[model samples]
Every structure is written in structure tokens, then in C-alpha cells.
Target: MNLDNILYWFNEVFSSLIFIYMLFVILVYSLMLVFAFLQLRKDRNLDKNLEGKVNLNAVYSKPVSIIVPAYNEEIGIISTVQSLLTLEYPQYEIVIVNDGSKDSTLQTVIDVFQMEPVFRTVQNQLPSAEIRGIYQSKLHYNIVLVDKENGGKADALNAGINVSRFPYFCSIDGDSILSTKSLLQVMKPIVSSNGKVIAAGGSVRIANGSEIEYGSVLKSVVPNNPIVVMQIIEYLRAFYMGRIGLSRFNLLLIISGAFSVFSKEYTIKVGGYNKNTIGEDMELVVRLHNYLLKNKIKKSIEFIPDPVCWTEAPDNLKDLKTQRRRWHQGLLSSLMLNRGMLLNPKYKQIGLISVPYFVFIELIGPIVELLGYIYVILSFVIGNIYLESALTLFVLFLIYSTVISMFSILLEAWSMGTYPRIRDSVKLLLYSLSEVFWFRPLMVVFRLQGFWYFIRGKNDWGSLTRSGLQKKTNDTL
Candidate 1:
């Protein structure tokens, strides 16, 4: 056969495969979007009715321990703690674990909260690194600070778990700020589920370019920065189309550590967070599922769409790439560690469905998508009928990003009303539609690098620079 003929046939097979794969992905996303919409429509009046009937201040409500793990978080730790102090829940204690920050994270927290060195016994219920000292806040009596050795985030969380004195604990990142009602809303499912829901998490919104005062989001505005705006779209897609749909049937595996609540009993039973992995939050959720499915226990982990955690997003491409790479790496590590559950009939939906979905779609998706982009570039060089195939594939990519992302943005607006301005929504709509051309390709490359890191046996908490959430800024969308 001629070389040109061989090239044509090879491109035919490869382009066909990309078409089929992209079609399957679009179908799945379509189904999830439908589920998400229905779920939101059903719970349309959830916040108002629940607020009217349920009193969060009553003793009948369960108290939660808010765990803030800090490592070089001097820039944002105090603000995070202050935000938690304003939680509208009936009772909760703030436990901040200072994971041996090289900076003044410990001292900054100490001086700000009027903390004094205190003798407090922290039970080693979960494995953790050694503790240097424990301090209690004099200004806020319920706040306890732990100075521990430099362990990664997962280890620091476990240390906080050991120190927490509540039946359930909420893990909030050092740079995260919660709305006053976030705790109440996130805990609503657990509080109402009659112990059936073991864990629950709320949505997270970018705090960049928003007005903040005293650790509270005084005004909500979309940032004009394209980098931060793209992240907002990504968050919307992940939470609205992904988790909310998965949680409808109890197959949800990943909930953000930045704003998730966990039952101490169940998390402890699963041996706490796995310090060996970069994605401890997801690993813990999957482990909880593994324990439940294997033991035939009837329980669920959930994602509540009502509450939102305001956290800072990296405002530059370099930092954004680092964060995305670390996230993708963590995802790969978690899935590989739990490969036993993949398509195993014994584990039912989690094994047969959720695990495989993440493995095939979420984990290796970037590689395939990268190949699709390559095929597009090569088709032009190879010309003729291949151009038709390339054009079709390009349109498919456009639909895959634009339709799904636009729906997510609309869902965010309909469900949360986060951005009141019409132009902000218009900006998000335009960017979501344009993502496949630029932002999506960049993510494809970055995530592939993350997959590479996982193969090389590298797991580390990547560094992220944070401006304190309370700092005033105006970058209008």
C-alpha cells in the first residue's frame, strides 16, 4: 500500500475513535445535567422552607468541630478562623492545626486571637505527627490551636481530628471563608438524614475580586480576570453537573475538603485521611464508600448544592497550572489506590459505575482530549476528506464545553443567585463558550502532566500563594 493511503486509513480509525469517545462523554454530561436540573428544581424552595421550620440555634441541632489545617498559611489562616467564628450553627468549636509553618503562621494566629499556651490533652484517635504545643484563644474561648510538626495537609487534618471534641467535624481550608449560614446549610442533610448520610459538602465559590470585611463576604462580584473567571466556570461544572448528579443516587466519590462535613465515627472507622496521598479529601470519601459497600452498610455521602464556601482562586496562569496539576495528580492517585473497586460487582454502583466513570472519563480524559486536539492539528496538514472529520470534531469539542458550561452557569445563577449583575452572567456565558479554544487545551496539557507525576510516584501538596480573603480588592467583571 502507498504511504499516503496508509496515513489516510490511520487517520480514519483515530478520528472515528475520537468521535465515538466524545459522543459518549457528551451523552453522559447531558444525563448529569438533566439530573442536576431536576434536583435543583425539586429543592427550589429548600432554603426558605427549611429556614422557616428549622432553628439552627436550638440545642436539638448537632454541634460540629470546624478543623482548619495550616501550613505556611499565615496570609489567610486568621481570616479563615474568624469566618468560622461567625458560623450560624448552634454550637461549634474552631480547631486550627498549625502544621509547623516556616513563616509566622503560628505567631500571627497567636497574637491576633490573644492565644496563650495552654495544657490541653489531644487524643490520638487517628495517626498524626508529633505535636509541639497547643494554644487556646482568649478572645474566642471556643477556638483551640495546635502546633504540630510539618506533616502534609492530610496529616494536619488527622491531627485536628484528634483534637476535635464533636461528633462531626467540618474541614475548611486555611484560605476559605464560609457564609454565616454555610455550616447550617451544609449540615442540613446530615442533620435531617437520620444518620443515613455520613458525609456532606457544599459548593465553593471563588473569593477573588469580591469585597470582604472582617472575614465576611460583604459584596459578591465576579472578577474581570479571565484566569479567575475560567476557574469560576470550572467550579460550576464540577459541582453542579458532576457532584450534584452523582449524589442523587449515592454514587458520589469526591467532595471538596475546603467545605465538607464528616461524621467523626465513620471517618475514624476508615482510618482518617490517608496521609500517603495528595488528594486526602477524595481518598477519604472513596474509602468511606469502600467500607460501606464491602460491609453491606447502608449509608451515603452527599453534596449539598445550597451552601457555598468562598475561597481564593489562583489569579495567574502559572499558579493556576500548578493547582490544576496537583488536583489532577491527586485524582489519579486516589483512583489508583482504590482500583480494586473498579467494575467489581461486589461493590455495586460505587464500583460498577462511579469508579469506572472517574477512571475512564475523569482520569484518562485529558490524554484522549489531547489526542483529539492533535488530530485536529494533523488533519489540516494531511488535508482532503480529513478536513471534514476535523471540522466535525472541532464542533463536537465546542458543544462539549459550551453547552455544558452554559448550563452550569445558569444553574449557579438559578440555584444560588451569586452574581446579581446581568453583565457578569454574560461574561461567564461568553467565556464558557470560548473555553475549548484556549482554557480547555491548557488544562488538557496540565492534567496530562499530573497523570505523568502519578506514574512517577510523586505525591506532594503543591504550593499556592493566597491573599487574605478579607483584603479589599476590585477587579470588576
Candidate 2:
């Protein structure tokens, strides 16, 4: 056949595939709307029952060891630790693993927390390179610190796991801050599950420009920067809509690195986090499910909607691109590492459904989207104006993205009422519109770069220059 004939056939095939994928996308959004609505109702009912007595002290009375793996976080380590110490939880220990930072991270923490070096024996069996020393807080009996060699984030977490003296361990980013009650709320289902809950993940809010006092958020005014505001909306959609449906099906692939709790025994049993992978958080979660399925164990890994942890988001293009690239690499690493489970009947929903969906839609989504865009643009440039076909394609995409974003907004308004101000809601709405046109394309490009980079064996961990969370001290309010 001639080139023209081949081009015509390719266009026809691509058109059909795009339409089918768009349908699936629409259906996913539709189901998400239903799930978010249901979750919103459940949240409202729970809120009514715990009105005045909804403090972390009342709900989560269990002992928890909060593990913070820090590399070079000198700028915010003191503030983050101070915030953790002030959390209203009755029983919890703070473990900070200093992963061989050349900066003043260790000294800063030691000086701030009044640290005294303590002799603790922890077996470094997880293929970690080395450990320099371990320190315990002189001021707080519950706070411990480990200064280790330059192992990765996964390595640092494993080091923490080995030393943690609690049944449940909460993993949080060094730069993130948890609400006092976030631990209490996240621990409720774990403790109340009668030993059935294996893992629980919480929602993470952006703290780019929010007014954060000590460790608590006094008010959540939108950021002055457009990038930060867009991220705020993105988080809302991801947590409120995307996770609700995924959790209901027991096919959640990721629990945010900002805040997630896991039963220490189960986590240790799964051989800890995968050190070689960039997406260790997700890899661990998937591995948990894989273990449950493989060993015929009945356990629950859940997403708790109410518990909130706030973290800094990238406000500039360079930082945002680096973050997204790492995210994409992590996703691919998780999927590929667990590729054996794909379509394996033993893993059931995770294997047959979730894994395949993520592989198709998420891991490789950007490439497909970019190609589709190219094909459509070529068609428009060429005189082959399939007017009805183009219109259908555009409408389908617009409706799906808009509907998912809208449903997430509605869920936020109904469930937590976080975006209370009318202007914030309106900004989110404006953001939703901008997402399809502006943000989505940029994301696709960044993600495509990630995929290609990964394929080319470029897996270096890029450092994100933190803009830092907006401290209340800086705000006039």
C-alpha cells in the first residue's frame, strides 16, 4: 500500500482507540463522582458524632513511632521537629534518620532538640551502605535520631523501621507537617480494626502559602502564586475523588509519602521498602497487597480521608518538572517491579484490573496522549477534516476532565469544608478549566520526559529546591 493509504488506516485505528479510552476515562470519572458523594455523606455523619471531642488525644491513644527520613533539610528541620513535638497525641515517639547529609542538618537537629548520643543496636541487614551513629533526645524521651551514611530514602526508612520500638509506624516527609489530630484520626481504623488493618494513608494538603503556626494551620488562604493555587486544586481532585473510588475497590496503588501509617510487623515482614525504586511508598503498598494475596492473608490497607498532613509544593517550573519527573519514574518503577502480578489470577482485582489499568493509563498515558494530539493536529493541518469525528473527540475529553474536577470540588465542599471561602471555591473552579488547557499538556510533556529518561536508564534522584511552607510569622494575619 502507498503512504497515503497507510496514513489513512493509521488515522482510523488511532481514532477508534482514542474514543474507547476516552469512554473508559469518562466512566472512571462517573464512578468517582458517585464514590465521592457517598464518602462525603459518611464523613458528614462521622463529623456530627465527634463534634466537640474531635481531638487527636481522644481518638488515637495508641503508641506510634513517627519516622522522618531527612537528607539535607536544614532549612525546615527544626520547625518540623518542633511541630511534631507539640502534636496533641498522648503516645508517640519521633524518629529522625539523617541520611548522611553534608549540610548542618544533624547539628541543627541536635542543637534544637538538645540531643544526646545514645548507644542503640540496630542490625543493618537491608543492604544499606553504612551508619555513622544514633542519637536520642535529651529533652524528649520519645525523640530519637539516627545519623546514617548516604543511603536513599528507602534505605533511611528501613533504618528507622529497624530501630522503631512501636507496633505502628507513621512515615512522613522531613518537610511536611501533620495536624495534631491527623495521627489520631489515621490510627483510629488501624487500632479499631481488631488486627485486620495492615496499612492506612491520609490526605496531604499543599502548604506552599498557607498560614502555618508552629505546626498547625491557622487559616488556609490561597497562595498568591498561580502555580501554588493550581497545585491546591490538583491535590483536592487527587485525594477527594481519585482515592475514594480506588480505596473502595481495594485497589489503591499509592499512599502519599507525606503521611502514611503501616503496621510495623507487616511492613518488616514484606522486607521493608524497596531501596532500588524511586517510588518506594507505592512499591511498598503494592507489595503489601501482593503479600496478602500470595500468602492468603486477610488484611486491609485503607485511605483515611479526614486526617491531613501539609507539605510544600513546587511553585516554579524547574522544581515542578523535577518533582513530576521523579513521580513518573517512581510510578514506572513500581509497576515494572510488580509486573509479575499483572494478569495473575492469584492477585485478583489488583492484578487483573488495577495493575493493567495503571500500566495503560498512568505509566504510559502521556505517550499515548501526545501521539493522539499529534495525529489530530496533523489531520487538522491536512485537508482531511473529519468534522464530526474531531468534535466528538474534543467534547469527550472536555467533559471527562471537567466532570472529575467538578465532582472533587463538590466532595470537598460537602465532606471537610476545607475551602470554606467562596473565593477559594471559585478559584478552584477556574483552576479546573485551566487544568485541561494549560496544566494537562505541561504534565504530559514532563511525564513523557520521565518515561523516556527512565527507559534510557536515567534514574538519578533530583533534589527539589524547597520554597518552604508559608510560616504564620511571615504573614500579616
Candidate 3:
């Protein structure tokens, strides 16, 4: 065959493959939408029944040790600590791991909380960086701080784990603030499961434009920044549509590290967080799944939709890029490390459904989608595309992006009633509709950069500047 014929054949094959992949993705997403709707409805009804029925401070509830790993988080650490102090739970201790931040993060906590040095012995169950000293807050006897050498987040978490004294442990990022009842709500599934659920994650909301008073979100307002507004919609889609459905089937692969509770015994048995990977949260969760399948253990990891942890979202382009790249890198690291469980029969639904979904749909989906975009441009330039078919696919992709995102926002408004303001809801809907044209593509580029960085062996946790979430009047810290 001539060169023209060969080129034509290659283009045809590529177009066919892209179409098939797009169809597969759309079908899967549609199924997820159904599953998510059902799960959300069920959860809402259950919440109604359980309202005022169970006491969160009951004797049967297990005590939790809240571990916060702080590194260069002086801006928000005080607010985080204050929030933990006000948790509605009956019995819990707060362990803050100071990961040798160059700033005055440790000193600020020490001075504000009136912390005094103490010699507390740790069991050293997990390997971690050297500990310089440990301090207990004079104001709050249960609040402890571990000043440690400059270790990464994972190592810091391991140090916290070593110092923690409880059957269950909860990890929260230094810049995050949990709702007063977040701990109670997140622990509900674990308590109801009778210890069969080893880990549980709560929903994380964007706190960019929200009013914060001593770590609690006073009034949740949609940010005017288009980037932040888009992120709010993104969070809604991820938590309401993706996680809830995944958790319903006991196939949850990741519990967000921003706010998650784990069984101390099980985490220690699985060797704690992997210090080498940037995605320690995801890696640890996957490892837990692997260990359970290998040992034929009957336990689960869950995602609770009501428990809300408000976190700061990237508002600018540069910061957003860095965050997305790091997240994608972490995801790739987790999936690659657990590649053996991709289709293994012993792992059941996890290996068969979740692994394949992450590998094909989550990991490679970006590359395929990018290629499709390029193909569209080339086809239009060459004037060889079928207009009708192209238009249909384009509409489908738009629906996948805008419509689904809008649905998620609507679901949140209907069930959770997060954004009480009708204006905020309308603004969120408008931003979701525009996400496909700009924000989504930009994220794809950032994620692709992350993939490239991973391949080039670049290990850097990009800088993140936090505008501390504290009301001006309440900024005493």
C-alpha cells in the first residue's frame, strides 16, 4: 500500500479505539451515577432514622487518638489545634507531630498552648525519624506535641502513630479544620460495623471563601475566584458521586488523609505509611487491602458522606497545578505499587473491579482523553472528520463534564444542604457548566506533568502557601 493508504488506516484505527474508550468511560460513569444516587438516598434516609437516637459519647464508642502531622503549617496549625480541642467526642487525645518545620510552627503551638517539655516513652512500633522532644500542653492535659527531625509527612505520621495511645487513630492535615461533630460522624460507620470496618474517611470541603471562627466554618460561601468555585464542584462530584458509590460496594481504595480514622492495630500490622512514596495515604490504604486479601481477613474501609473536614483549596493557577500534579503522582505511585492485585481472583471485587477501574479508567484515561482532543483538532484541520459523529461525541463529553457535575451539586444541595444560599448554589451550577471548557483541560495538563515528573525521578513536594482560615476578630493565635 502507498503512504496515503497507510496513514488513512492508522487514523481510522486510532479513531475507532478512542471511540470505544469514550463509550466505555461514559457507560461506567453512568453506572456510577446510578449507584451514587441510590447510596446517597439510602444514607439520607438512614440519617433521618438515626437522628437523636444514638449518643456519640456512649461508653461503647471506641476512643480515638487524633494525629496531626505539621510541617511549615504555622499559618493554620493553631486553628487546627483549636478545632480538635472542641471535638464533641467523649474520650480522645490530640497528638501533633512537628516535622522540623523551618518556620516557627512548633514555637507558636508551644507558646500558645503553654506546652512544657516532657519525657514520654513511645513503643516505637513503626520506624520513623528521630524525635527531638515531646511536650504536653499545660492548658489541655490530653494534647501532646512531638518535636521531631525534618522528616517527610509519612515519617511524621509514623512518629505520631508511635506516640499515639489509643485503639483507633485519626489523621488530619495541619491546615485542615474538622467540624465539631466530624469525628463523631466519621466514627459512626466503624462503630456500627462492630470493628469490621478498619478505616473510614470523611468528606473534605473547600474552605477558600468560607467564614472561619476558631476552626469552625461559620458561613460557607462560594468563592468568587473561578478556580476555587470549580474546585468546590469538583469536591462535590468526587465525594458525592465517586466515593459514596465505591464505599457502598466495600471497594474503597483510598480514604483521604485530610481526615480519616484507622484501626491502630491494623495500621501497625501493615507497617504504617510508606515513607518512600508521595501518596502515603493511598499507598497505605492499598497495602491494607492487599494484606487483608492475603490473609483472608473480613474487614472493610468506608467513606462517610456527612462527616465534613474543611480544607483550603488552591485559588491560583500555579498552586492549583502543583496540587494536581502531586495528587496524580501519588495516585500513580499507589496503583503501580499494588499492580499485582490488578486482576487477582483472591482479592475479589477490589482486584477485579476497583483495580481495573483505577488502572484503565483513572490512570490511563487522561492520556486517552488528551489524545482524543488532539485527534479532534487534527481531524478538523484536515477536514476528514464526520461532522455528525464528532458533534455527538462532543456533546457526550460535555454532558460527562458539565451535566454530571451539576447533578452532583444538585444532589449536595438536596441532601446535605451545604450551601444554604440560593445565590451560592446558582454560582456553583454556573461554574460547573464551564469546567469542561477550561478547568478540566488545565487539570489534565497538570496531571500529565505529574506523570512526566514521576518518570523523570523528580522527588519534590511543591510549595503550598496557605491563607490561614481564621476570622480577624478570632485571630488571637
Highest-scoring model, lDDT: 1
Candidate 1 TM-score over all chains jointly: 0.98
Please report, in order, the local distance difference test score of every candidate based on alpha carbons. 0.90, 0.81, 0.87
Question: What TM-score number comes out for model 2?
Answer: 0.94
Which window of ten consecutive residues has the lowest lDDT sum in model 1?
52-61
Q: TM-score of each candidate?
A: 0.98, 0.94, 0.96
Per-residue lDDT of 1-477 in model 1, one digit per residue for the tens? 999899889987988899999999999999999999999988885666467246564424578899999888998887788888887777889999999899999999999999999997788989999999999988898999999999889999999999998999999999999998888888877877777999999999999989988889988888889999999999999999999999999988899999999999999999999989998999999999999988899999999988889999999888888888999999988998999999999999999999999999998899999999998998888788899999999999988998889999999899778988888888899889779999999999889889788888877557877777868887874
- Provide the global lDDT of candidate 3 against the true structure: 0.87
> Model 3: which residue pairs collide?
none
Off by over 4 Å in 3: 2-4, 47-61, 384-386, 472-477
| Alpha-carbon shift of residue 151 in model 3 (angstroms) | 1.0
Relative to the true structure, candidate 3 reaches a TM of 0.96
Candidate 2 lDDT, tens digit per residue, 37-109?
7876876776533642554444445689999999999877776777788776778989999999978999988
Model 1 lDDT, full chain set: 0.90
Superior by lDDT: candidate 1 or candidate 2: 1
Per-residue error (Å), model 2, residue 205: 0.5
Cα distance off (Å), candidate 2, residue 165: 0.6
Candidate 3 lDDT, 8-44, residue by residue in tens: 7887787778888888887887777788888878877
